[model samples]
Each structure stands twice: as structure tokens, then as C-alpha cells.
Target: MADSASRAVFLLQLTDCHLMPEPGQLFRDIDADSQLRLVVDDVLASGLPVDHLLLTGDLVHHGNAEAYRRLLDILAPLPGKRHWIPGNHDEIGAMRAASAMPCGREEVDLGHWRLLLLDSTSYPDGRGSGSLSETELVWLEQRLAQSTERPVLIALHHNPVATDSDWQDEIMLGNAADFTDLVAAAPQVKAVICGHLHQSQARSIGQARFWCSPSTSVQFKPAQADFLLESGGPDASPGYRWYRLYPDGRVESGMRRLAQVAPDPELG
Candidate 1:
């Protein structure tokens, strides 16, 4: 039998694929199909003990049906469990068609921990806004209530609280306070994982930790002033973030940036 207490759950985080499988490019000089393919290749070749693959969001460039289809094809070869959450650029209809075991909510039991996937997307507006709705909040409260013994990890596409980066702060979740309040009361809530900033960042809110994953496509340079969008400069290597959640309720993570052979002409 599988030793429930001894085993650990490893979640591989990949975000912002921005896949534009067609001939044309998308997202500020990024070739979605090529860059995403490279990241996928790296993930598969890493041979890491990944219990599940989590695509946080922005999997497609335009949230179109065709883009989602292409993404499904690219990710088809990946073994192990997979979970997805929609972002500002995600199409609900397209996601439904692409995922075999599609679900808006995933409550995965990872031995001593529980992973909760939440959808914080307000469609049509590119700026982020998180709404749990009364129904969803109630469900979440109940879920957390079920057991205080298991460490709970919350995953969402938008940053639940302000990150101080002015550019990203504009697109942050509007209902972040409400969400934080909920997590504060729940002792089991360990950390909050998110992707949308297109850059890796970390901040603490209340008793929880909030982390943003770097993109598999183009990256947004860390800002100091107001909102700024980074364009071509030099670094073209693709990157991803790996997070380890310890049984003692501690967390450790790092970024892995790959070296591409040469800059693609399409990007210039």
C-alpha cells in the first residue's frame, strides 16, 4: 500500500505560455509555439519527481479556440496529473474542449497537504479582479473547515494582495482583502501561489505567503516606479519556477532559466 504519511506531492508550475500556434507571433515579440515548446521540452527532460503539473494561466495568447487546441497538442505528451486555471487571456469554452478531466475547482489531497485551485478571472477586462462569489466562498470555507490538520495551499492566476510593484499592482485582484481575510482565519492555509505578473516575485500578506511565477514566454522586468512593459533587450532564455512545500508547513522555491541556442529572427 502507498504510505500516505511518508509520500510527498510535487507540483510543477508552468505559467504564461501565451501560445499562438499559427504562423504569426503574439505577446510583445514572443513566438508562442516555439518558446512554449522549448519550455515543455525542458520540463519533460528534467526527470523531476513531479506528482502533478499546474498550468496557472495565460496558456493562450488570445484565448481563442485554435490556440487552446494547439496548447492541448503541445501538452499531450506530459504524463502525470494536470490542473489548469483560467487567466485574463483564457477562454472558458476553449479550456473545456482542451482538458480531458476539466474542472473549475480541484481539491487535491497531497498526503499531509491539500491543494485548492481557485479561479479569480473577470473576463473581458485584462486587469485582474478576484471574486469567490458567495457560493464559492461558502464552499471554500467548508473545505477548509473539513480538516485543520492538513496544510492547505491555494493556487490562483491573480495576485490576491498588492505586491508593491506599481505595474503589476494595477492589474492585481480587487477583492484581495476579502480573500486574505478568509485565509487569515484558516490556520491550515499555508501559502498562495499565483502567476500573472509575468515575473517572479514574492510577498507576505497576513499569515500567508504570495508568490508569482516567471513566464515561459517573455518576462516582465522587475519595476521600481509606475507601470512599465519591458521589451527586447537581450535575455531570451525561457524560465519556470519550482516550489517545494514541506510537511512542517515551510516552503522553498527557485527559478530555472534555460539557455536558448540563438535569438529567433521573428523576435527582432
Candidate 2:
């Protein structure tokens, strides 16, 4: 590893691992467990020096115990310091069985970045919302005030802005405008990262950059008018986003897709 002061902070962003016990179903007939394993294998084989692996959420499907167990089995061998925030399909209690990941709040200092992982899965209808409770907002405000020099990266399970698709727009962060106001008020906020959209996108609002990473399982076609699952194709391969954060306040980000070999060639 290079000197922490000079080396760019490298983070791997993974999301939406909707694992199911039975295989060959929806979402391209892609087995979530196998796809996640393939991503980890490729990341390890590439030998990229990653500072942390950040999973934004939907770590499991149906929030079942067995699914969480399978998620653990796949992630146990993957290298690097890991952190996670849950999504709509995840259950806080079930995910706790595998790791000590934050359920609603987390803060970490990585080089020049102060990362705040928020739990934005606060909706009743199995969709996502971004309502930071009064307590959480106060805590975040205090943290922002204290660390004015370091760039802040906020991670959540929902996109803070609409992707302009009707189906997704309806299910996205409900209190996005309020969240945006808070982010705009805090100049230390350099970027906002999230999952749930299952696609790669980068947008700018105020002075901050917002990025949504591709999923480790399936991906939704961006800007499609209706809700639809993607088919098995070159674009649906499991992948992640790599972020390079510079001390001088510049960010260079890119996507990396795993080369997945069908578990059973005959089935395909």
C-alpha cells in the first residue's frame, strides 16, 4: 500500500444482490450467489488495491435468514475492509446475523473523506425513502460542522434524485428535495453515492456529485418508461463501481463488470 496521505482513496461500490435459493428465475435467470462470487473473484484476481468495499443494499431478497447466510458465505472470503447499508428487500435483524454493519447510522474517516452511511429504507410500502430522523439530522449536522476540511461522502439505499423514469421516480427517495437542501447547505459534502437503481449514473446537484453503481446481480434498463427486468446479455453482467478520491477535491469514478461464465453452459 502507498502512503495514505498521497495515495488516492480507492473504494469498491457494490449493490442490489438479490439472492434467492432457487436459481433460473427472474432478473435474467442469473443466480445471485454465483454472480456475487464471480464479482469477488474478479476483484481479487485484478489485484486492485481497494481501501474499502461498500455495499449500498438489497443485500438479500425477501429478507430471509437463509439468504443472509448465503450472502455471508459469498462475502466472507472477499478482501478489504467492508461496510454496508441496507435497502428495501433487506431486513435489519436478518443482516445483523452475518456482520456488524450499521443498520441506521455509520461514520468513518478514510484519508481525506468523512463517510456517513445513512439508513434511508424508511418507507412502509417496500419502497425507499430518505427521511433522516431529527436525531440523525442533528448528528449529521454536527459531524459536518466538525469536519469542514475533509470531503464528505454520504451513502444511502435510495437515489437522492429522480432518474427521470416514471416507475423508478415513484419509488425513489420520497424526501429527496429536503435531502438535497441539506446537502447543498453543507459545503463539505463532495459526493453522494447510492444503490437500488441497479444502473450506473453520475449526476451533479449544487456542488456535489451523485453516483449510482451497477448491481452485483441484475441491472434495470435506465430511463425505461415501465418497470421491467433485464434479460441475460452483455449488459446484465454483475459489476461494481470503483471510486478514486483525490485529496485536492477531485473524483474520478468508473465501472468494472465481472466476466461471468455460465455455471451450466447447457442451460443457457
Candidate 3:
């Protein structure tokens, strides 16, 4: 890792890989493993400086231990310290068991800033909806108070802001207002990055920006009233997000998308 005191720390945020336990398994008709590999290949080809790899969530669709292990294997070639949070599809215990890296610790010190990983899957209302628990809220408040000087960047599985897609909006962070209230009060908190909507998006609350990245699997069509899977074209592609966080509280983020993936015709 680069000295955060000297310069900016580059963080790569890859979300929603959705890998299955089986080696050649496909999720939603997409070759989940191959798609992730493509993204990995792109990252290596880009030759980006990566200080930490922050996987926001949904590393595996099956919640199997092997899948989590596989995730590490696939991402092994990438450079940086790795961190991750669980998504709705992940089983916490299994993930912790399977992970070679630290699993339950929520905050990581990147010198100038502290990255906070919240548990949005604490309260799953089934059908993919998630909310932060009261206990988690208290923990967040304490962490914020403990390090008021360090700029904060929060990562979680669910979006804290609505995506405007009716199906996705209903399943967004359930206690968003409460979450927003706390984040709004903290001026040092710079951004919130998430993964569930399966498409790249950015929104805001107060001084904080919310960045939602596309899945490494398949993407959901944005700005829709009904649930719709992106079938073809650029929108259906597998992609990831990256951010360059500087010591002076600057966060630069962008999306890197692989070639388009056509939806499986057999499912239809």
C-alpha cells in the first residue's frame, strides 16, 4: 500500500460478482465465473494502481464456502489488500469460514481515511430487501465519533438512495432516512458505495455521494417501473467501479465495463 500521507490511495470497488459454487456454474444464464475473469483480465490490462480491493457484496449467489474460496482464487492475481462485505445471497458464517482474509472487522484504516463496511443485510425482508439494524446504527455512530478527523467512505450491499426503478427502489436500504440523517450530520464522511441494483449509478445526500456499481454478472436496466433484466447492448455488460481517494478528501470514481453479454436464450 502506498503511503497515504504522501499521496492518494487507489481503491478498486468490485461488486455483485454472483459466483456459484460449481466451477462452470452460470447465474441468470450468464457464465458468472468467466464474466468475473474478464473483469479481472481488464483490470490487469489497465495496469491501475490498486491499494485496496473493496468488494461491496454478493460475492456468491449460492452462499457456499467453495464459492467464496473461488472468489479469492479468481481475484488473487490482482494487487492490493482485499476487503469484503456480505450481500443478501451470502451466508455470513460460511463466508467467514471460507475467507482467507479477515471477515468480520468492519473498519479499515487507509491512513488518511477510514473505510467503514456496514451490514445492510442485518435485516433482510426476504425478496432481496435489506435494512440496517439499530445495533449497527449505534456501531456506526460510535465509529464516526471515534475518528472525526479521518475522512470516511462507507461500503455496503444495498443502496442508501433509490434507483428510481420501482422494483429496485422498494428493495433499497429500508431505513435510508435514518442512515442518511447520520451521514448528513458528518461532514467528513465523503461517499457511500454499494452493489445491489446491478447497474452503475450515482446519487447523493448532503455532502455525501452514493456510488452504485454494475454487477460482475448481469446488469439490471435502470430507470424502469417494472423489473427488467438488461438483455443485450452495453447495458447488459459485466462491470466494476474504482475510486481514487486522496489525502485531501477527494474521491474520484469511475466504472470499467467488459464486453456486452447476451442474455441466455434457453431461459426464455
lDDT pick, better of 1 and 3:
3
- In model 1, which runs have C-alpha deviations exceeding 4 angstroms? 1-5, 21-24, 123-130, 224-227, 231-236, 260-268
In model 2, the worst 10-residue window by lDDT is 259-268
For residues 168-257, write the lDDT of model 2, one tens digit per residue. 988887777877888999888888988989987788758898888889988888888897766667566677887788887777777777
Number of the top candidate by TM-score?
Answer: 3
Listing every candidate in turn, what is its Cα RMSD in Å to the true structure after a full C-alpha superposition? 5.9, 6.0, 5.6
Q: What range of 10 consecutive residues in model 1 has the weakest lDDT sum? A: 259-268
RMSD in angstroms between candidate 1 and the native structure over all alpha carbons: 5.9
TM-score of 2: 0.88
lDDT of each: 0.73, 0.78, 0.84
Ranking by TM-score: 3, 2, 1
TM-score of each: 0.86, 0.88, 0.93
Which digits, one per residue and each the tens of the lDDT, describe model 1 over residues 216-253?
88877776466554565434456777667777776666
